[model samples]
Target: MAVTASGVFRRTAIERADQRVSWERTDQAFFSSGACHVLAWTCRDFYPDQGIALAALYLGDFEHPLHVYARWGRWVFDASGWNLESELLQANSDFEGLPVREVETIRTDLREFCEKHVHRQPHQYWADPTERARAYVARYNPPWL
Candidate 1:
């Protein structure tokens, strides 16, 4: 089966959540095993050339989740995960509003961004504190760091 944009989104979400979990474990000295998962879609209006991306992130577990929606002009997060409604879907075309060719472009760009930059690489860090510190020093830090 071919991998879809939704699949890439889900996997990327999980990987991000897992990194958070690892950090939390290191800080709190407790371990919990679970990953974040996501459901995502895009919304577009060709006439206006406007678009939005929406996603729900099941953080660590499915019991509670975070909702995110973003467009060129706005970005929002709903911790309660209560805002999703049928009306929103209808208004946005369920992300099928853009031309068919644009769908592939969006998917490819998203996947590449997530894989290349957003997702953490294990080799970027080290188990030994000294080595980790040295690695950090050697690396070119981005603004986010």
Candidate 2:
């Protein structure tokens, strides 16, 4: 079923992921490098404190909460606070709507953040993304990220 952006469909991850992947990739799927995954989406905002991220995919899409990764083999709120798909952070999901220019800022900021964290190491592995990611996820989650 087709869904209007503002309706209940926005709250469902499956539907949302489908739309996001279609929109961004235009079916290109440049980032889907693994055979084990099924979907991906852009981020509108991320809550490291809550371990969750809000999605904003496709211009027609809206921001809403979605699961990032699991913790202790169970789904928990420990989000990674960043979406590689979007290459940005949704700093405030509560914002019902924001301009594209503002959203673009998120991408820029994210790149800067990654650079800061990745400097001073071979192959640019300065900060442990897995460990730092846990700062946004459950404590007991696998450290193998």
Candidate 3:
């Protein structure tokens, strides 16, 4: 699904100092990549009260290290410490109402696509450290920040 600029989704506020430090560390890792290929999709939640799920994959360094992030309702789940495949399947099933088999298929397709198409360096804006920082700030700066 296309990401909208409607301002409906806002970054969750960091209430504790530890959370702030952790977020900064994660953000640093995310932006440290010389290049990254991103794949994102939005799916309807099976539980209507939970709203929608926004899922994204960040591929870098030929997939030696990949990252997955999914937002369901107000919670953001990461594949940092959990089992990646199981986490992905669970998220897809819980948020998208997709069957296990279909989620597997989607995962395979995404992997193939990344393997085939993400060989080159990222755009200049992403490649340049200064530009990347500017872009990040522009994209994520909210009133609360």
Best by lDDT: 3
Lowest-lDDT window of 10 residues in candidate 2?
A: 30-39
Instruction: Give the distance in Å from residue 35's predicted Cα in candidate 3 to where it truly belongs.
Output: 9.1
Itemize residue pairs with steric clashes in candidate 1.
Answer: 42-95
Candidate 3 residue lDDT tens string, 40-130: 2211221235442444332222233332333443343331211234544454344434344321112333345446545222232223233
Tens-digit lDDT string for candidate 1 (1-145): 1111221222234444455434333210111111111112212221134354433333223232222222233232111121233332232233334222211113333344345334223332222122332232233221122
lDDT for model 2, on a 0 to 1 scale? Answer: 0.25
Q: Cα lDDT for residue 3, model 2?
A: 13
Note each model's CA RMSD in angstroms: 16.5, 17.3, 16.0
Query: Higher TM-score: candidate 2 or 3?
Result: 3
Ranking by lDDT: 3, 1, 2
Candidate 2 structure, TM-score to reference: 0.19
Query: Each model's TM-score, in the order given?
Result: 0.20, 0.19, 0.24
Which window of ten consecutive residues has the lowest lDDT sum in model 1? 27-36
> What number of backbone clashes does candidate 1 have, counting pairs of residues 3 or more apart or in separate chains?
1
**Clash number by candidate, in order:** 1, 7, 0
Evaluate residue 130 in candidate 2 and report its C-alpha lDDT on the 0 to 100 scale: 34
